[model samples]
Target: MNAENEDFVRRRQLQVQRELEDATRDEVVVEPETGRLPVCIESALPSKCIVSFDAHESEVNALCWSPSGRLLASGGGDRKVKLWTVLRGQHQCMGQYLGSNRAINSVTFDDEENLVLAADNDMASRVWGVSDFRLKRS
Candidate 1:
């Protein structure tokens, strides 16, 4: 190869090596104190896992997890609230209830775990029997 081509290749190789070294290097800073022995610490660990669930067609306004942590309920701008089940580490939409004409703002499960209370911007609140998802009238 020509000398000019060889020089270009060597420069590119050096640049790549420098980048790799910088990427793998640990960046840390320590402050000195007068009364105590110095201590060394590594940087905080990064998050290892993330789970994202997209069950609502519109903006999600609220969410509640079941007492067992095996299920989730989500209320959204679509004026609906949905219940989801976590099976084998994946979230599955189990049921949906259209409770109001306007956006549902909040949701919570009752003490017995058999009732769900939902409030919406429609100036109404609803209580639903969790077993059959039937509306409970006051």
Candidate 2:
């Protein structure tokens, strides 16, 4: 119809196309060689395991998933708890919570996903606020 109306329609169509593309895109797109999308991630629930990788220097003893499933917390024999961001079968360590005297044995996310609790072999348990990873006492 009018030029201004035609321009508005064109812009709307482009915007919709972009939204669709983003919706279907692989969530984790890192340097091609740095990450790989596993079959399990691509398929919601695969009956078999397809990919596996080492996420810690030593054996991983505990794991906790954020409420949203986008973040993963893992405690290992290295005496550290690592926070990982998982997407599209790719897991990247985003941060680390250290200070445990011994290897961490258990890790869990709080109900609100705002805190993480971890226990170490030294008979110490600590709580870390998810946002700043600060030691919390109360």
Candidate 3:
């Protein structure tokens, strides 16, 4: 690649690394009574929206919270699965998992949290590596 192109890619990589670092540094503060999440008095559960973000281009169809609740996986009508890092009620888009040809209908994280699996409108299911966002199976 040309020097300028390489420089641009390098800068982008650094930016992503910094974002990841910031997300990881922030801790999720859980209330003792609510277990691992905060509670809403009106609902008597953790149903409150502490924060929100533009998660997808189209309507979100499915959402799955990681075992630790630190990460969230969302599949949308836009044919994409996006990962989010949630810390202390704040959220940031971490990465996107691509490969679905149709809108995703459901999503879940593997028990080990190593893979993200989604079912799409195409009548197909796909699995992607959590860390690398590589398609593992379809």
Q: Which 10 residues in a row give candidate 1 its minimum summed lDDT?
A: 37-46
Which lDDT tens digits does candidate 1 get at residues 1-138?
A: 699998998999999877767754766555466445435454343455546877778999989987777668889998888988877667788788765788889988876678778899978998887778788842
- How much does candidate 3 score in TM-score? 0.66
Ranking by TM-score: 3, 2, 1
Reference-based TM-score, model 2: 0.62
lDDT of candidate 2 over 1-138, digit per residue (tens)? 699998998999999877767655647444568567544344222457654678789999998898888789999999888898877777788788878889999999988988989999999998888889788852
Query: What local lDDT does model 3 show for residue 6?
Result: 88
CA deviation > 4 Å runs, candidate 1: 1-49
Candidate 3: residue 25 Cα off by (Å): 38
Could you tell me which 10 consecutive residues in candidate 2 have the lowest summed lDDT? 38-47
Shift in Å, residue 96, candidate 3: 0.3
Q: On a 0 to 100 scale, what is the lDDT of residue 128 in model 2? A: 85
Flag regions of model 2 displaced more than 4 Å. 1-46
Estimate, for each residue in 1-138, the C-alpha lDDT of model 3 and write its tens digit: 699998998999999877867765665576788567534332222347898888999999999999878789999999999999989877888899999999999999988899999999999999999999999999
